[model samples]
Target: MKKTLLGLALSCVAGAALANDHDDRWMLSTNLIFNALDNNKNLESDFGLGLGLGKFLNENWTLDFEIDHVNVSQEGGGGSVDQIGLGLMTRYHFSPDSSLRPFLGLGAGYLDHNGSNNAQAVDSSDFMLNLSAGLRKEVTDRVSFLTEVKYRLDTDDYTGTASSYDDYLFSMGMSIALGAAQAAPAAAPIVEPAPQLDSDGDGVSDQSDRCPNTPAGMAVDMYGCHQVDGDDDNDGVKNSMDRCPDSRPGAVVDADGCEVQVVIELQGVYFDLDKATLKPESISILDAAVKTMGEHGTLVVEVAGHTDSSASESYNQALSERRAKVVYNYLVEKGVSADRMTWKGYGELSPIATNDTAEGRAKNRRTELVIQD
Candidate 1:
């Protein structure tokens, strides 16, 4: 009678899929089951557990796999009945959009059970057909509560005497949705390597050659330019003619190859109100200094800070030192190497003008960049 009612219920809901219309795509369900074994009058009601993984094929249909384990107690108190089942199921949901969804499912499962008692009569492993109907109620967006009943028709002979075995199950459990908002797979980026060419045949790739054209059979620098045509210091004298190969750029080079010493004041690098902080206007001037350093990679420079004679020698010296350090830090931040630069503070000693006059004091308070060959 119980099997007939379950079959009828399953037929009523068979066409609809057993999933909610919401966007959740993955489901995990766990339930406690009550198993009633027919004609095993010596066995008491058993407790079981069923676990299922379900996927929504669409809003109205779901496909699932379930596994169950049960331990049936013996009324006569000698042994226990153990049963395990595995099933592949499909469900049709009747009300996917509602908070309370009703569904019916049909599946086939393999059930294996054995009684350990020496006097027990049933020990069989058989495949059976099952019918089920269930209700699911949403308790939260990602979770739902479920109640279900199922009946399995097993045709295997039990105790080597019975025609068939009737197995009924009742379950109540929870379902949780998983990975609903996972990010979609991203397309991979395509990268092609840069083309390589050696137009000058100087044993260097053209893409990396600083000087691309050179006469055939002429010795060339690493840059693929003619070695004899190279100027090491870029001071307008070729390396073959310049005696000082490291003469500083833009300097006056004598016949013997030495740069004339010249002092360059860093214009616009001025401080306000006895503070060591550099003014905003000084950034452009310093930026130019950084560019010059990059252009002449081998050039070294000294950053010197100066202050007027109005303050005490000690105070002016400390302030000037701080001012010079600030300039040094700024250049380092701009990617200049620290080893290529040095800093010094000259206080009240090297004034270019008379300290008694305001104009002279303003002129004395300045920063200077001293370049080295």
Candidate 2:
């Protein structure tokens, strides 16, 4: 037991070099445990104590190394049995930053029963896995109370016995979160604002005014002027310097009033089930993309197609390829130059959301237009 605990600590320390940036804190915990042994063990339920050394990887995740000890007395007090356990568990926390957090976990471990002192003197070692759920309630900045239950699937037979047994562990404990040992990101320096003073009283100050001799009763922009009226195109650049007078709404425009192509997620673009043909309702979104490309003559696009994991990997890959090709062909038919675009299929490899629910699956089936330099 000592050797195992030492190895676990050494392994965690050695892993620190590769994990400093993600180490949110260290979790030190202890639990009062009730172990319900399998009937095959011919043992009664017993109370135990547990110790844990864990690393919080982020707001939503933690990896814990655990050790527990329990002793059960024989029915007639003929003798007592001792059990020691060691495990490594990873947990996913929900509502991590909230005052109360809930988590679920899965882990595997080894258990040893010492029978050297018993009249039977038959020892056994076995492997086990557990499914766990728990809740943590905050008490302070560094401390929290924890309650959890685990169903352990034990494997292997007791010494000279053929039947296997499982165990249930009910635990309650407190956890202490250690401080981060790494440096944090640097903060921006604070700058005091200069005093506001205007000599002409036209709102444009003498220290910043490009034109101070503006005639009274006439409107002027920040850079006092008679010809430029704020911004006509409303594209951020002044009218006097705006080479293109009008620009599309929500478009990325350059300083000279030209559109600058950037990556875009085609939100409404979708296809029919098991088919690559574009849906009628999705045409408007594609048309908008085409219009943007036409407005920017030098703009290049990469049509990327993705899909949900409803089908086989090979089938999804081919389906995604067809979807990309269909979009590529549509743009070309609409006068987009063939040399200005490319197409690729990512299949189900890149998912933006979980696929375990219907809404998430719908979101996973998506398309994107990437701009190339």
Candidate 3:
């Protein structure tokens, strides 16, 4: 029964790592214990003590290393037993952030036991496996009280017998959280407002204003210039200097007023199940997108992320947005100009495939790159 619980606790540890979000990282704990050691035909129970240190891989899961020591004396005197152990355990908490949390754990360790001055000297040194269940109650932000019950199996020949030694331990203690290890906040976006018409209040719009920054109340021409200048296309370039006189309105232009072409697209970037994290295999495809953008340095593109209809609408929307931001950040780190990129999430609202099937859902969960020039 104890072995089965240990196996389940190990499974919970993996599941918790991928799902939990809270991030308080390290813990130190101590416990006073009651131990019952059974080695058929002889039973002894006594007081023990333990010390442990734990690290949270995620909010709901922790890995702990512990040392335990116990001493038991025979009722009739002239005999005593001593045991000490060191072990490693993994635990899964049911409610990590609550005032009260329940947890289950599994551990394996080495134990050294010695019996002194007894009619039948019992001595053994071996490895032990244990399963435990516990409850913790918060006393403050950095402190908590803990109580637990554990069953350990000692795999050793006790008095030359074949059966394994089964030990039960009951303990209560306190835990202290260490350091400030919460996850950092997400990055805030940088926003630049669009340039406005008549920004200087000189009675001219920026598109046609040759001297757009002319001092306030200055007298100006149709060109919004302090001096007379002919610019037929109203593209800020004097007509004599205009290389592309018929430039399209709102088109990005060089000093000669010629429009620039900058466009690129990416398709098929994928993510893990219900997560914003990019899958390893999707890196090559995204790198291709990066290469294409690098070849066209001035390209402005939108990176849109989408998800299948599996989770709640709000959750999918937020998750998709994070996924898009992850790709956008990746590109920025790889030398793509941040000013040329924008990102958004479409969530499950714009699925390209049927969400009812696994294959279709996979097809629907993808990111797309669209040229905006």
Candidate 4:
């Protein structure tokens, strides 16, 4: 009986340590034990039932008091014993897996043992020191099954019982978690409405209504302005909606909504090596220039040529003029008006960079296009 009470106290401590929060709590447990006597004396096996109330002091400790009852029988007769014990138990959880918790507890408790004449009883009710080792397997989130082996050191006293006893107990029980497990109040979802403006009944809002003076009956985007279609120049017919995106006030425009005026720039360079003929790559560059001049009917272009300082002055002058005329003839072949194009050559006299290095000489030999507006 002393051992059974000790085991209950230990299991309670284990439960308290495994529980989620620190709070005073109660647990009820039942165990079946096989009782044995010290000197090989035959003793009846008994069933033990225990109920414990414990307060969790912290994660690793608990204070528990338990009541236990055991009924034992011999061949002839049997009786029951009731015990009440109070203990302070400490538990160490050796692993994070809550399902299997192994712990040790050492506690001192006072036990009052009362038995009928038919049952073997200790002669005294005294203070006993208890040590227990136990394991709990969590069957569910809130409950567990516990088993323990315990030793109780009953300081011998008036009852005249042995100094100590051992108990092996197996029990099934549960623990209740305190905080997060409780039901929570429901919350309402939040909804936000779209912004409404343009409140003044004009075509604009108080904010960003820069065109508050905007006339009515015009379409608008979200910012409260006249709906702008393709107004690339912001003249407002939107290039798609505007008949002439680039037209000056009162200027004539073609059917495609573009002004008839043209502008052109002849800007690029060519290299002279081993021949006076234009290279195939230079022909492609001049083709692009010609196409640009054709797109704008009234445009005029000035083609300027430059030469490096390696040659005699007159020869370099003639070479520069030949390069300039080469581009001019290509543009004319592509149907640019001869009256609107002029070609000029500035020989090595107009060197843009030093000719001492190959790279500087390359830069000094060049062609340029100046647009005549």
Best of the candidates, lDDT:
2
Ranking, TM-score, top scorer first: 2, 3, 1, 4
Query: Which window of 10 residues has the lowest lDDT sum in candidate 4?
Result: 34-43
Q: What are the TM-scores, per candidate, against the unseen true structure? A: 0.42, 0.50, 0.49, 0.37
What is candidate 3's lDDT per residue for 124-243, written digit by digit as tens?
A: 787778888999787765678999999988766555665568889999999888975334345579998667667778887887676768888778766676765587777677775579
Per-candidate clashes, comma-separated = 7, 0, 0, 8
The digit string of per-residue lDDT tens for model 2 on 1-373 reads 4345435534543443233213346789999999998866666689999999997653455778899999986555556778888887777678733768898876767878875333677477777666789998877657889999988766646545544567899999999878743243355799998887766667888776766787876787766655744677678877775678787654567866677877688999888656799999999988998898899888777999998766567777898899999999998998899999999999999888765444566788888888863
* lDDT (Cα atoms) of all candidates against the true structure: 0.74, 0.76, 0.75, 0.58
Residue 6 of candidate 4: its Cα lDDT?
61
Q: Which segments of candidate 3 are over 4 A away from where they belong?
A: 1-25, 39-43, 117-123, 180-322, 325-341, 344-373
Q: Model 4: per-residue lDDT, tens digit, 1-373?
A: 6667667755665555554323334443444433332221123545566655554443345455655555544335555444444455555545432458787867666756556535555434666666768886656434557676656565434224445544443444555433343233355588785464665456556574644655667666544556545556543335544555666543434444555543233444455452357766677778888787778777666777777765467767887788888878878888898998999888788876665444566677788776654
Candidate 1's residue-wise lDDT over 60-161, tens digit each?
Answer: 567777899988777778777777887677776776446788988787656777776446656778666788899978776568899989888765554465
List the candidates ranked by lDDT, beginning with the highest: 2, 3, 1, 4
TM-score of 2: 0.50
> What pairs collide in candidate 4?
123-159, 124-159, 219-227, 230-238, 230-239, 231-238, 237-242, 266-369
Task: Estimate the TM-score for candidate 4.
Answer: 0.37
Model 1 residue 342 CA deviation (Å) reads 75
What CA root-mean-square deviation does each model show from the true structure?
27.7, 11.4, 13.0, 32.7
Question: Model 2: residues >4 Å from true position, as ranges?
Answer: 1-29, 39-44, 52-65, 88-103, 115-122, 136-146, 155-162, 173-208, 218-222, 226-291, 294-373
